[model samples]
Target chain A: MTTRAKQFISADQLLEHWQGHRNLTRRVIEVFPDKELFEFSVQGMRPFSTMVVELISIAGPALKGIVEQQITEFSEEVFQPKTKEEILARWDAETEVINHYFNQISEEKFQETFNLFGQYEFPVYQNILYFIDNEIHHRAQAYTYLRSLGIVPPFFWERF
Target chain B: MTTRAKQFISADQLLEHWQGHRNLTRRVIEVFPDKELFEFSVQGMRPFSTMVVELISIAGPALKGIVEQQITEFSEEVFQPKTKEEILARWDAETEVINHYFNQISEEKFQETFNLFGQYEFPVYQNILYFIDNEIHHRAQAYTYLRSLGIVPPFFWERF
Candidate 1:
């Protein structure tokens, strides 16, 4: 027998929570020196810029797919920016895209399974959590890079 | 006016999600060579063992505080295990402790704000999320360490 799903958080709270993380990550991008943002990585991990691009590619695109009920192929090759300015511009633009699509999801839709990128078959909410989780995963790498550079990264708890 | 808070996920789901990350982290610990587990560092970051201790210090202790409704000072000095087996033993023991206290928390308790460690003041749910979030944060660092050592980390998605 299947158990009824209980809501753990509100959609508004989830959006705000995800956005708080985005804001913190944006601050991370801002703190990086222009050259280092694209070049600095410890332990053979991709540079912070590359990691940021992976995040940029996921949330807005995946949400759009979820809202539209379509499974589209995931790709990070959509943008090839030579500068941090270009990346930040896309980040701000994607924020709006995320907001637009996130509100379209009804609370009930969160429990429906969607095969994200034709691979990860999980509930809508779990997929959304994946997006946020993946960001935190990469941002931690940036934190190490920052500490190595002797630059203090933004506080992890100050998510607003 | 205070708005009604909606539930987005169940406490069981939250515990499962957190444990998934912990399982992946445990794999990382298991793959490490004994000496390197304690000494390896890239970019001046602390060794993975130290980070694991920090995580161990939080989840069980913090959850116990929340369940008991007591605010205690946060400290990582409680455990000073000198071996990987010691750390793993403590990890397994703490898992039970986490499950014990986690079930004691009522749904309404998730909405109440508590001063975590006499430091972080947030709703019970947010505090719990922080515990999970903090684990992923440190575990990501361990992933990098593993990669640098030519040991591939456990698949991040394979939480179970």
Candidate 2:
């Protein structure tokens, strides 16, 4: 793919897209009852809070790594939230961290390959897309968990 | 959002990104045993087959509506696939259909507002995105179902 020659998305639009999904995910986090958020899982899927840690850990760190041109080991251990409020607080703080680093990325840099968490080697944009994609994937689980508990999720289309 | 002034994603990349998700969903559909695919549910969530029908009915039809500039009522009733093979067949055909109409949309048109199925009015690109996003949403339920059934799902990152 001629990454340098072709631009499909702008830095701003990409960030907005990522953040919109993040916004919806925040709603998912908000709606979860305190107990279920930390403990609920379908069969063997991770609890929404565990999933939230995985989501919280990625984008900001990955974007920071991309901007710094450094490969760091991925860790969710640093954030072990005991409550829903703790998870949401970290989520908000991480949003700022994401915006700070995300804005630093040049469009051309998006095409450059980065070994994310020193594991998955992909173009920077793909890695960023993974961050967004992974969140959506996990949030989908939380939605099912919510539904099985008889709660309606915020609409998927209402990203903003 | 200066939709015309700034191009964030090219048509090809957007379509490819979408198809990758579809490919993953296809694999998810493939892994389910016939009965579980048709009958299993977590609480009262729709069965995987029903979810697949909702998926099968979108994208191709939505793209067709966008290309034709006609708002048609959305329906999954037209494709009540009784077997896994039928779902896969329709899925493959719809993929081709999606490609055919998706390529017809010029970049400028991505920003145009269209009332999808006379229900959700959104930018054409967002509508297309909804198709991909909704698939992921439903597929997550299928994943939970698979795990509940003691089956391992395909890796989420291996979209291709």
Candidate 3:
């Protein structure tokens, strides 16, 4: 028979999803040529490169704050000019940090609620969703940017 | 013949992931008992309900702003205390709005970037990630809440 139905979630699985989603985001960045990454814009919006910088920023100190119960200590990352390669490099770095932190979570910690920026309170799982949801929100913008360029970014439907 | 193997990316696949991911976050709220939804917290945090309100406020207003290309005037969707049911209703509403706006994206519009909060220059794709990332971040906190209650959430592996 299949393994027991594990209704209880695992930090590993959450981390996996985190990794995969980041993969998708990075690929989307890759699909865009260097010119498109920095120059293209829909409605005079921020460039893709700027968006990637913001992405790099979410996990490093942000996750730490939620875990330790303090504000992120730095400004919410704002996008600025950066090379595509630089964006990708930071993406990889942030992924590593997030994975390392998530791996540290034990089952007991899952149910505990914590302060997110001294504002909202939620369980660790809910916080995980916040991270993912926020990324998807931003990714949606990327999808729009990709399509507007007539270069289809990867699919939004694949969960696996 | 199929095109080059570019990360095996598919927009449809990403959406599937997005939908599943969203459902995961929405479901966590349902699993949470009403009492804990409002008052519980770990290490002096707010409440799970508080985070949900923040979500409803951010996702809807952010999307509205992006699609309409003007800073949105938001209501107290995320401010003040909200019942679990109210949060659920808002969740449903945001989903509908996001899907509807996404449908309007055309190939030509991908290149047009909309200003996000007048703070940073981000491509449309980056903006979308903002939403996803925000959600996941919060969801992680929920996981902690569920675990602290000795309640195991759905297997995180299934999140994708």
Candidate 4:
């Protein structure tokens, strides 16, 4: 594959991983009765629904700001995740936002130096990896919730 | 709570979210048979373990960079997550690294813009939110794997 194709593939892999995890998590949620969605937990864990909202809130602006190269001003937006339909909508919105950012990257840009908060230094590419890394972290928890529910999610091997 | 107390509480909340989710995901991995951990998937999903590795590799550095405003230099190091033992070691190490940076943050830093991959711009705090957001994304996938195995990993709402 061409180098650019390869880069796109990385993004494709990320998107697949991101969406794949969500797909499975959704199954866990769908199986729940609505009341249980907010209230149930296997062990002092957040309810599946609460976690679902957690995922919903992070995508659009959180990733959006990073790709857009703007500083994030954290807010209660995350704490107040919208309805399921809204989460889905924001999820879709984040995809477009990410695609816009991903396609916008020139090879040179990836190599450029950028300051994170004024403390640590990083290249643009490194920041991208951070984005992917964080996704995997939380997805892992959702996996636990699924297992606790006794519903098998998608395979971990098929992430790519 | 006073405003500063509230902000601190929120920050703690975010950190706790990461920790709880990470723990839940790690548990999912522990329950998996080595074969299934690496091989099971339904459709367009990964082995779940790979996702964990990537998450482990990225979490500390990502947060440290953002909190410290450091520049990221992407290398094989960014993607080459270590073995389980190594990851566990690094995970502990990052806790210290992340703590140092978190303590160092000036409130102003949250509002300052950073060039994330030089693609889009965002405040540092948004990057923090993204960190939590992305973690949940991948953790959800692990939930899928747990269900597939006919094991219930844990409840989601019981985060500390």
Candidate 5:
């Protein structure tokens, strides 16, 4: 007789986890002093604003693309918001879109492979996790920038 | 008539995504110069070694605890590996354990909430994502430390 293994988490929990990261990232954006968000970099890496643009371009649209099965070309257009409030608005807007598109995905479709942004083909869940991973990666950079500027970032665990 | 949404990934795909982050993090650990891993810090935050210990302590045992329905107390024991090689070994060991225990999870259990490590009561999947999130957070710190030390971290997209 063979016993079955239990699942680790549900789709809803995955969405919650993704949102938690997004929430923390939004807070990180809020804490950045205006000039530093666009000016600070370590060893000539891109500024935090550019990183935010990359994130903004990817999160909502990528999920929508996956949901729609649309193989869209990767565009290089980065939204240049003039202020922190503008960035936050864009971020919040994208967050809503992410929720809307994410719920459109049912459990079984997660196993199907899709070419994300007309680029790499992987399981849809992998693509979504990439969104979360990329966000955390950039947020870490922002955190370092904050510490360098003598400002403390929000504690890592405060994801609510 | 109701329209149904498609799921874009499976539990297996989510595990793959989590493993990719782990793989990249392992590469980050390997690339660090011996002394810098433990000695470097920004604004007096904990060193990268301590961060790795936090990751090691949380991942394998956390999954095991979740799978076995055991609520273990969080331990503050940071492994003081004398060498980078030692750190890599511990990391590899934990990685193997993660794979072994992760496979033990079934799809249904993901929807059930578990108090991970006797704290942070959430669905098991959220807890696992927390593992990935925490890793990315610290790895980014290590990236900053590497840049500050005039070393380059592995490319963020090279998680394979």
Candidate 6:
């Protein structure tokens, strides 16, 4: 049933949308105090810095794998950035890689399915969406952590 | 510089990606206790139910406006659903409307710019992304509310 729906967004727009969310998530990361980003968590969830590492590992590398059609094993070298600035720098580098790899994805490739990171067989578009959805999910956790620390996150509407 | 990037996803994939997020958000809403859904807030933000209403107001109607080329004024008559069941019903109805209007959008229509809800002029694709992004933003707030109340949110990957 879901297969019959028509395409509504172009590949460029999808990139834009993904980038907008990334931008906002970056801002959310910025709002975190240095210690809390690496050390804080509610219940048993990982800290915001840990979550950022997961995102950093997925986004740029996943796009490269998808575009290159190389279904490599998912092995994230855990990045433990002690400072928020270091984390932000890693985030920026990943952002650049995402942009570079994303541009290599032609419109036709979006329809082709690939086993992303040697798992999760879905079309390229869905894979990209997973990258986005995953970021939103973790960032939500970070938002909770921020609020708990009596910090206000950057406004959601400011994506640029 | 960003404008020259090629599109990566078709319209249908975008819709699927969006619906997945919406599905997860619905589950998030369901997880909320009845009174707390409407009453709870962290750092003076509006309750989750209120955020849901704002979403309900925008999505279906925005799609209708975009497809029909009717740039109507944005006037959200606040819906105060008394029960979780009522909220779910409204959500389901809006989901249906979103499907219906989303199908009305043609490939060409997505490229044309429309002043969404009489504000924020962008192409239809960006506007649709806005809807998804806004929902994610609010749902994150809801997640924080849920965790703070000792309720675990639905797993982020289980969007299907």
Candidate 2's residue-wise lDDT over B117-149, tens digit each?
A: 999887776777667778888898789889988
The sequence of per-residue lDDT tens digits that candidate 4 reaches over residues B1-160 is 2222111123443454456656665565666666676677645556666766666555566656666666675332454443455545665676677667665665556557775533336666655655555556665666666665677756554343
lDDT per residue (tens digit) for residues B1-160 in model 1: 3444444567787788878888888988998999999999876678999999999999999999999999999999889889999999999999999999998998778878999999989998888888888888888877777777888777778888
The C-alpha lDDT values of all candidates are 0.86, 0.84, 0.63, 0.54, 0.82, 0.81
Candidate no. 5 TM-score: 0.89
Evaluated against the true structure, the overall lDDT of model 4 is 0.54
DockQ for candidate 1, C-alpha atoms: 0.57
**Segments in model 1 whose C-alpha atoms lie over 4 Å from true places:** A1-6, B1-6
Winner by DockQ: 1
Model 3 bad stretches (over 4 Å): A1-160, B1-10, B73-81, B108-111
Candidate 6 lDDT over residue span A18-51, tens digit each: 7888899989999888888889987757888888
Q: Chain B, TM-score, each prediction?
A: 0.94, 0.95, 0.80, 0.75, 0.92, 0.93
- Return the TM-score for candidate 3, rounded to 2 decimals: 0.47
Chain A TM-score of model 1 comes to: 0.94
Deviating ranges (above 4 Å) for candidate 2? A1-8, B1-7
Give residue A135's lDDT in candidate 1 (0 to 100). Answer: 95
Model 2 per-residue lDDT tens digits across residues A56-125: 8888888899999999999988988898889889989998999999888876677678898999898887
Native-interface RMSD of candidate 2: 2.5
> Counting only residues 3 or more apart in sequence or on different chains, how many pairs clash (N, Cα, C under 3 Å) in candidate 4?
79
Classify candidate 3 by CAPRI docking class: incorrect
CAPRI category for model 1? medium
Ranking by TM-score: 1, 2, 6, 5, 3, 4
Assess each model's interface with DockQ, reporting 2 decimals per model. Answer: 0.57, 0.54, 0.04, 0.09, 0.46, 0.47
Alpha-carbon shift of residue B125 in model 2 (angstroms): 1.4
Q: Which regions of candidate 6 deviate over 4 angstroms?
A: A1-7, B1-7
